[model samples]
Target: MKLENYNVIGVMSGTSLDGVDLAHIQFRIKDKKWDFTILESETIPYDLTWVQTLKTAVDFSQIELEKLNQEYTSLLASIISDFITRHKIENLDAICSHGHTILHQPHNGFTLQIGNLPEIADLVQQTVVCDFRVQDVQLGGQGAPLVPIGDRILFPEYDYCMNLGGFSNVSFEENGTRIAFDISPVNTVLNFYANQFGFDYDDKGQISASGEINEALFNELNNLDFYQQNYPKSLGFEFVKETVLPIIESFEIDITDKMRTFTEHVALQIAQALPNKNGRLLITGGGAYNDFLIERIQFHLPSIQIIIPDNKILEFKEAIIFALLGVLKLRGEINVLSSVTGAETDHSSGNIYQPK
Candidate 1:
């Protein structure tokens, strides 16, 4: 296949801390428009040890983190190679990865995303584009919710695009300007509590459905200062540890009750971010699988139309968006929105690493 016609693979590791998602996508631009088809997709769950390491990676020392980054890059490369071989993939154009986020404190003038090492390109022997956020952050941006650019470009029919991943974020246009922001923590806190019960997640939110809501704790979360902040803001693991965890821990609520209350907290925060009071909202991400959580959100925001797409879209939307980001970067078009990220300007971002 020609380079323009060749297929690309996009990778995403979300905050839900679920696992790495790989989307083998065929992308092309014809008549000044973009089109894509997901040829294959898969989620590779993290091992218990890797999960623990990534969970605590934010606090690691510089030396230790540098070492970890190299290892993570190697691991990502290995996985991509395995996926390609297993699927008998040929004519690969490139691989774009939104590597696992490690640090996103952009206000302090720094952000880091591991697994962008050149070793990945060498291993996969394909053009690679990764680390799409640092440059935007350095240019005075939030370094987050980058998917809105893809949402606007690829899935523009909906009035709002709400993703209930590890974090809840919504993207919509207002006054003819695109805007998005992180509403609150979602699976990040939910999965944390779920681990206490020896399960990776609360399947269909069974535990939360069985628990009672603690009004006090729910109110505390709702009253968070971040909720009062304006749009173009984002969240990180640090926010959970500092703002959310402390507030939740102060309450003497049972684990199930805490889950139920927090689920409500997430639902309300998400509902509040919807721009149009009565238009359709396209919801995706793993949290969409949480029946109880969705019910809570729907209950709170009855005016909005919540539409969940196919299972593949729910599972691999981030990876799919990352692929679109790569396409934008390759074409030198704007991939990160200044309106969304508070960047100096909207611009294309990502560093391409060609195999040696």
Candidate 2:
């Protein structure tokens, strides 16, 4: 299938604080069918200072956050330019960036993504599409779990699409309606603890497997009110620090024990989201690399078939979806799902910036 000029760079910085994923992809829609080829992909890890700033920015005042937003935009422009130059990319269509989500307290009717500066378009010399979640939030939506629209469009074969990145979010088609919700914390909380041991992440779930589960903490996490609140719900770092951290800190458990119990919690929550016992599930994001976590989830739901594709897909699934969202926006199609986000209506979302 062939379509008119369909190439893009998809940029994503997830809440996990892992890194920026840049995927140069070629997408074609012919006769209402969509296909894509990943021409190049790379992940650039955040510097220690940037990581620290992002982690602590939640506590900053409004002025501080404003400055940080500008600084973050500058950093994004620089990194994106480097990526484009390194790949010698040309014949470009647009750069679709899911900017680093800084503040996501959508119940207050606002959401902020920090790296959508017009300077990025000037620096990269390309059309840019970003700031995807605010409109939905304004319309009384969760302003998250936005990938479900792409899941429905691009990977319709899988009965469920689960992404385990900063957060665990699952999406699937149920009764001809697409539904999704954030299940639990993932790399965000795990990496927070892992950093104490001087490791960016628990490689292949080694640290978690070696740890013992703190039964008290495990039960507390399982019984959290959020878990029982029902679907169309989302989570952010605020939820982590305000709700999760305090609960975990109340117990005098070792770091390894905390990891173990949290891993169990994540697995159980994810397993519970499966709509059908025997349906095929496509799992992506950094959590898919956690063998121990996968073991626990599989143990919990033995009948479901869990499939993990290549490392690129696992890492850049969200980035790819952001690119698809950009395509939908460019075509003036509905990219945000009302069912997934609890919005008043399904609609296209994002702002477009053309290079000056």
Error of 1 at 179 (Å): 0.7
Residue 273 miss distance in model 2 (angstroms): 2.2
lDDT of 1 by residue, 274-330 (tens): 755788889999999999999998898888888999988888888999998987777
TM-scores of all candidate predictions against the true structure: 0.97, 0.98
For candidate 1, list the clashing residue pairs, or say none. Answer: none
Which sections of candidate 1 miss by over 4 Å?
A: 1-6
Candidate 2 is scored at a TM of: 0.98
In the range 105-170, model 2's lDDT, one tens digit per residue, is 877887888998777788778999988998899889999989999899889999899999989999
Q: How many backbone clashes can be found in candidate 2?
A: 0
